[model samples]
Target chain A: MLTNRSEVVVKKEMSLLERIYIPAILAGMRITLSHFFKRKATVNYPEVKRPFSPVYRGQHVLKRDEAGAERCTACGLCAVACPAEAITMVASERKKGEENLYREEKYASIYEINMLRCIFCGLCEDACPKEAIFLTDRIVPSTFKRGEFIYGKDKLVEKVDKRVDISKRQTQTVLEFKQNKKFAHNRLYTDKQLKEKH
Target chain B: MLAFLIYKLILVVAVFAVSLVVAMYSTYAERKIAAFLQDRLGPNRAGPFGILQPLADGVKMFMKEEIIPGTSNKWLFILGPSLAMFTACMTGVVIPWGGTLTIGDQQYPMQITDINIGILYLLGVVSIGVYGIMIGGWASNNKYSLLGAIRASSQMISYELAMGLAIIALVMHTGTLSLRDIAAMQTGWHWNIVYQPLGFLIFIVCAFAETNRAPFDLPECETELVGGYHTEYSSMKLGFYLFAEYINMFISSAVISTLYFGGYNMPFVGRFVHDPNVLAVLGSVFLFAKLFFFIFFFMWVRWTLPRFRYDQLMNLGWKILIPLALFNIALTGVLMYLGGRLH
Candidate 1:
């Protein structure tokens, strides 16, 4: 009565052939046999992986500058932005002769993100002012220990020789916004700029 | 005489080994086929294409913790799977695997035994297989197990009538009960299927039921019975039950091939391969090829169709199959009488 798609139920007797059910069974067998040769829908994981979108947020990575200096300035904005409260760190003053290791005067002496609690929302990537934290497409491999999932700088930091590409996460608009000089607070003032100002 | 006895012993061992090997691979094939039908890769780990999966499964079964229920009848519980395995392995004895292998000055039959009532013996062994399930279920002291066992026994009893009637039709035409004689009679394209197609159809349907396979596998129906009769069984005891089912499938396939599909007989092969020994080997290969096809057919039907309702299963077995089988026997009898008159 509502859609005109519903048909009336019939209680008619089946013919001899229909009653036997052999024909219908044969037809069904034919359908399944065809599917036996059809391409499988799932790939072998670990050995084969499907392509991911550029903006796909998976594991976190701590980025490095061109000079291979750690770019984080011990800011707590990412930790505050993380809804899961999975991030924790201790700030320490960068000592002399450690400029190559720490880009800023204050750096995170100990940084840890409990991967087990992090929901992979990419908020940390969004909250990073120095562009030092990024969510990459690489999956966090599973481990037995809970402590292992609490990723320290050793696990989260990008290697000097092997870099993770997060250029795709930076949209054209974001790139253009970064280029604008009107946002002076967004600019990172280097030692040369400080010297010139003094 | 001693040589003859030794030869017989070797034949027995060979048959037993071959059945066990085929049963093992049948388990692997069942999983692979189930996966393929559903558009998925099944068990490609462990070894190449999961060829070693059965071995791994056997190991896993052995390593599992064995538990015998404290409240259950220990002797009968132990006997349950043993009886199931025993009957499953016993059914292959009379199946004619090939033509007689001719040695230097001696001739040897490929089958273990060719009793005059070979078909009767098969029926007896298969019917006795129900006791295994019944005893197991009764011994388990579980309601679900009891229900499953009851269903299994009733289903087997219902289907055996139609199966017997179907085979009776085949026997009427062939005029012998010995499987070897029946198989030998179908040499060079005179396959029984040509004469008894309806009988073949009935036989196959009944075979599916007797083996407790899908659509007819109500005994171990997982949805309702909670692992059915083997719910209380664990470890290799459970493994034995599962393994016995596969062995039964293999034996049924062999029986189907022998009865209707021309066991070990390839048309016009005798013309080219004159050597008796070579012919025997070729015939054995042909029989095995047929057996594999039937085994595949069993799995194919399983994946293709959903399980039948209990009432519907009974209706088909008793109301439909029995009458049809009777009609087949009557038809065969009429044809035989007419042929005799003409001769």
Candidate 2:
């Protein structure tokens, strides 16, 4: 329990030199002088990026199959799994000719996920039996209006191939970009694309 | 007239450049000092030993947007830091950096100005230093700013008394208020610190309070006032406040050296350096070393000591320093009179 009583602890007496101002001043100076020679912790921003954890959450991207078909089958499972109720799907019958493209007999025709409401939990991917959705390592771009965050199939499709070979090449390029010049001047990704992935 | 004007221009430019450079380095030094005190490495990456950190900081400050609050007195808010920086830079004019240097047949003193009452001029300049803080705090129009200003003004005023009293005692012993005369008097092994130990101690303590250094740094108490007078300041205006602080530190160190540590005089430097030019250069180097020591001392104290409360600070100034200073003055006067009579 908390008490109003003050506890008193007796401290040891200071030496004669410590009592005087000069010695204490000298001791402090010694400390400062040592620090004067030590290394600094500042990372030169734009030029040098600090190492980020592998598990770091960034922008999100939807996955694609080997044949470049979107993994999502508009089953409304993601919509049900979404805690924020951000995902919405409109099912349409898969035509006889389009059976190879979509895994489900009924695929989502008007699928929209409100990026503002979506929690980036990968639960939509987990819920799907076809493994049709995955959150890729990307950041959502900040926006002024709530309407801009409603991501459709056009925005959610993986534009770039995430194959191992392509990822390796991209990683090297990103590393080189960080080293060769300031990050602000590097324009590998457009603002719109960054926003879509995010 | 043209030649005289050119000479004055050169002197002003030289002093301004030196003070600016010294003040910039002092910031880096303060950071490094604090880091070391806490058993941490300071800035070492900007350049070797973080020498270029100040330059980086200056560039960063310049690049930042100048923010002016809509409700503030824009004119006075702008005026405050500028005034602080200007006064701090101006104080370097009267300080004798070294003895006279002879080139061809002409002799030029290292100091910019050698007015008859140079010491008094320094005191006057230091007294006006308070106006900068006062104006800044008042102009900020914040309650914390106003309170800080009030504390700073009163603190400076209180300490100035003890400081003035200490200087008076020194003046009595030297029989002149001229800094050059006082410097010349302390020849060979006879530095004023030996004769006026008590006066030096009082003056040093008052100097700490005057500069608003740690243990006496009540004005900008971060816990209480959140950056004090410069809370609302941004960009180069904020830079000016920070820059002015270092310049004040440099000037205070220089003043301490001049009054107590014998300015630029070295025990046997005159014998080794026969040429006036060599002597002047050597004297300036020695003066710089001494000044550096005092600056380091200031930084050391800043990191070591905890700040005093408002009431405690007032009590120490009024109840302790003033009385001790008064007694020391009377004692010095009586001793000087008796010695003269005996002679």
Winning candidate number (lDDT): 1
lDDT of 2 by residue, A74-101 (tens): 7677778778888887878888888556
DockQ for each candidate?
Answer: 0.75, 0.20
TM agreement with the true structure for every prediction: 0.92, 0.71
Docking class of 1: medium
lDDT values, one for every candidate: 0.92, 0.80
After TM-score superposition, the amount by which residue B217's alpha carbon in candidate 1 deviates from its true location, in angstroms, is: 0.8
Clash number for candidate 2 = 9
lDDT of 1 by residue, B1-343 (tens): 9998998899899999998999999999999999999999898897999999999999999999999999899999999999999999999999999999878889998999999999999999999999999999899999999999999999999999999999999998898999999998888778899989999999999999998999898999999999899999999999999999999999999999999988999998889989889999999999999999999999999999999999999999999899999999999989888888211
Q: Write the per-residue lDDT of candidate 2 for residues B135-192, one digit (tens) a residue.
A: 8889888988888889989999999999999998888888888788887777777789
Q: Give the C-alpha lDDT of model 1.
A: 0.92
Counted clashes in each candidate structure:
0, 9
The candidate that achieves the highest DockQ relative to the unseen native structure: 1
